[model samples]
Target: MAASVQIVDYVEQGQSLYIQLKVIDAETGTAVEGEVRFLGELLYGELIHEKKSPLADPVRIETIAYLKTHFGR
Candidate 1:
């Protein structure tokens, strides 16, 4: 027995993507439907700024600048 998936619908809103799917069971020829949503690409990522690190100040300054440019105050 095997299963196959077919895309039933798709949608995009703001920062999210929604998908609807239909799956069929080959053995019994039964079909099921479901929906799934995924958040769009990640923006800023993880930051490791140890207080005693040599590049701490530089990293902080750069992060601030980036935030101001992208997200405003």
Candidate 2:
């Protein structure tokens, strides 16, 4: 799988929210195709799936968040 990352929201240096899109192929190393791949309920945002085909779950796309995996823990 591949990841397309972007800062969804930012409010200073310490308060920023990001969104990583799962829109790439792992084996073929290509892009996934769909209209509404990433479906999130984070208030508001624009999410788009990659482009291409699939043999398995190349369609069930989603996003990732890095909310304090607690870097200094």
Candidate 3:
């Protein structure tokens, strides 16, 4: 069964925006729930001068930058 995805907006304590992706059953048009593990490429950010901040992962930094850019910090 094909699943459709949509982003539900959310904000974290660090003032970063998050996309709560929802997976829906394509045929029945129902929100498919229960621990759905998804593998996806981290969608945004520029690899700046390889320095480290509190954000330890590259994907986390990228996602935060993406949200700030897209949603306006």
TM-score of each model, in listed order: 0.43, 0.23, 0.29
Give the Å error, residue 67, model 3.
0.4
Overall lDDT per candidate, in order of appearance: 0.46, 0.32, 0.38
Better-scoring candidate (lDDT), 1 or 3:
1
> Of the candidates numbered 1 and 2, which has the greater TM-score value?
1
* Model 3 lowest lDDT segment of ten: 32-41
Candidate with top lDDT is 1
Model 3, span 1-73: residue lDDT tens = 2444444644444433344544454444555322111123233222211353223244334434544455555
Q: Candidate 2 lDDT, tens digit per residue, 1-73? A: 3443233333322333333333454545665433221222322233331333241233224232322231211
RMSD values for the candidates in order, in angstroms, are 18.2, 8.2, 12.4
Q: What are the per-residue Cα lDDT tens digits for candidate 1 across 1-73?
A: 1545556786778876565655554544566555545455432222312353222344434433443343322
- Which of the numbered candidates is closest to the native, going by highest TM-score? 1
What's model 3's TM-score?
0.29
- Order by TM-score, highest first: 1, 3, 2
Candidate 2 deviation (Cα RMSD):
8.2
